[model samples]
Target: MGGKSRALPPTRGTLIERLRDPATAPAAYEALVAAYWKPVYAQLRRRLGLGNEDAKDLTQAFFTHVVERGSLARYDRERARFRTWLSRLLESFAANEHARSQAQKRGGGTAHVSIDPESADHRLGASAPVAADEVVESFEREWRRALFEDALEAFRARCVELGKPQRFDLLLRADVTEVPPDGSRPSYRTLATEFGLELTQVTNELHAARRELRACVLDALRARCVDEDDFAHERRALEGSDREIER
Candidate 1:
């Protein structure tokens, strides 16, 4: 470690319980919506053939319904992953065209978090409408991307706090940044020259940075899970790698 050590970010060990607890449910719902809203919006657009405004309104309304109805409190982690359960709920919500219309007319209330369409819409871009099954397939990919993005942001902020932002820059260039067309990364010697460090120092810094990033990613990933088993399963599926999600 080349800088002051910091504790890992918060993890929600009792996510299920917190969602069920009235006192904690608001905050829990906020975190849940923030994590899943993009995928929900995307699925609504693709699976239901809704335009951006309709999808955005429906997304906001769906989460509002969930929060008002205590829908997440009914989630049984043993039955399905949180995302799968939420997807089912979204499908039900989207199926009710009358309800969707009403929600849109009323201008869907804020659902414990702001539903920003601009960023999600930009990323979704203009693609031919995908099938319902394809929407489901893409949902998992979107969720995985969100996980790593949250992790990377947390890691970057932590590096700043530790006065080792260069460590993150080094890691980003060496690993996170796009590689050459031939799939080659900058050599360690090259990185050393760029960062003004010895090769040994570069190696040590990268190792430590990677370890910290893994911790940050784990924190983000685990916070969305209901229990230890769920976290373990997800960690295994991620395969202990830091590869960027292919859009």
Candidate 2:
């Protein structure tokens, strides 16, 4: 029998480590913004009681500050979770910026940061009322949602690369949503008929696709951890919710 295959290296690294490396910092910062901007924007809007436009500008400015300051590189993994650290950082930045905006108004000078309101709305939806105490919870929720979305996209791309697009679609239809698009749920038999495969084949393909998705998600989460313990903690936090893979 052949020995077990070695696990592949993670596709990326923790944001802090990436920010420290000049070669990887640019791409890593882009990924960080894509993964985090929504939550950060939403949190800012809610916590600061700012209008949509103001929130958007501040969010853009925050990312600019991060890039200029190499803020992620300053994160100490032992001190706090990245999300916690970021929430505090954003709060401080928002307060300081708000004060600066007031000072600028007094001096009659204007400052602006370009942000796409439509994009922000599409990602975060209509602004809902959130209690001040719940801001942290809201940020964590959005962060997890974004992380899962990234993982799902990565899984889809991997499926395409592996020539298993049908398998990926089948799994999404079967496990992620209602297949019939109506009141009734579809069964293995129904899926087999729809996909023109044997019932056993349908079952096998879905199983494989789900396994691959789990691996992809794990790899994503692993990239955010600074050490084995951090990775394990994040894995539990991710899998601890209602979004566990269906058997």
Candidate 3:
């Protein structure tokens, strides 16, 4: 998602700003919700290993539990990485799925969900020796995907607000985001012709869009890591985990 778009990338300053006052800005929340969705869904998928429909239901339930139980509101940066804290919460829910099922059968008041603990045990390495490779498929991996999607959503919204909706779409199509490259990408002139915008106007729009996008992306990344240095470390950890699974 961190692709070249002839615009400056996000900086650390803005990331700190958004993290400090997320409720004050819709853009910040958008970036956040986008970022965490993946990790959460990934956790649910691994835990349930259910049919698509069941997985979707449990995913929704997990998110609902997180929000309703004040998960985000009570988050503590000092106590744990976001992933670790959430993993615990997921384990709680999974371990109690049977109890919840009974509650449902009795029609009592509780947000019942079939959250099985065996999957959680597997993820947490509580069971007999399963290769570390087997654990990479857990929800932690989705953190990256969610963060990128949130930033992209914010970028798109910023473009529309600035009356350059089409140009925003062009940014996605013109650049292959999966493998970002260095150097000047396509110019406004090319985008203008392709999207039928005046050259001068495209330049202005691109400039604004790029600036906001950089901020959004960086903030998304920052919210999910320890710091800039930790960001690289977390990525390395992820790489090692993936490689382990491959082997």
Candidate 4:
């Protein structure tokens, strides 16, 4: 995904480098929080069996602790992917918080990330509790969901900037929306009619949108990586995910 097409604008440095720098830390931290807070909150709710309010409070506290304590600086790319490292860090934080028997006040932490527990909870629906063996699996699923969501938003903004908002609309309808009960996607002919475009134009615009979305997703994934090797591993994992989606 990070290979050629750029989804996000260029930043001053890698995620870790920016986080460690006083000048760029705020923006970097904001981006980090936006990307992972949902996944963290989901894990806290599902994996730890915490109530909604508790999950939200602990999510805020965990991120604040990470920022204030400089704990992420200890992450070693050689030891694990940043996703794995962060998940482990969350596990440790939650365990300690439980032991202390006091949840930190929500929105009271130094971290600048926004916590939207209601939205996360809504997305999770009223599913049964996640099994212990599936905690990591569920967390990674939320992570991928968050990654694509951010990329889709970025892609939409890019489309609007290009003065082709209809392109995003078509992509959203044809690909992003849930399939029909019959498992059928809207046909290009149907989209062409709905958007008042030639069938060929529909095809071309969708191709461009998908291409851009792929680039955007890669850029998002790359931002979280520590190095080229880390990016390579993650890109492979993402490609595997893509294949699964295709299947």
Predicted structure with the largest TM-score when compared to the true one:
4
Off by over 4 Å in 2: 1-14, 21-24, 45-57, 70-74, 95-125, 178-185, 241-247
lDDT per model vs. reference: 0.73, 0.71, 0.57, 0.76
Model 4 stretches with alpha carbons more than 4 Å out: 1-10, 49-53, 98-126, 241-247
Model 4, position 218, has a per-residue lDDT of 91
lDDT by residue for model 1 over 1-247, one digit each (tens)? 0111223335454667777778887777776666666667767666655556666777788889987887866777779877778777776776685465557768794333333686356436645565555555667766777677778889999999999999999999999899769878899999999999999999999999999999988888787776788777778778844356567
Clashes of 4: 2
Pairs in clash, predicted candidate 3: 35-146, 35-147
Candidate numbers, best lDDT first, in rank order: 4, 1, 2, 3
lDDT of 1: 0.73
Tens-place lDDT digits, model 3, residues 7-54: 223434433345456464445444444445556555555553443344
Estimate the lDDT of model 4. 0.76
RMSD of 2: 8.2
Model 3 per-residue lDDT at 146? 64
Q: Distance from true position, residue 179, model 1, in Å? A: 2.9
Residue 133 C-alpha lDDT in model 3: 41
Error of 2 at 50 (Å): 6.9
Q: Against the correct fold, how does model 4 do in TM-score? A: 0.76
Model 3: lowest-lDDT 10 consecutive positions: 1-10
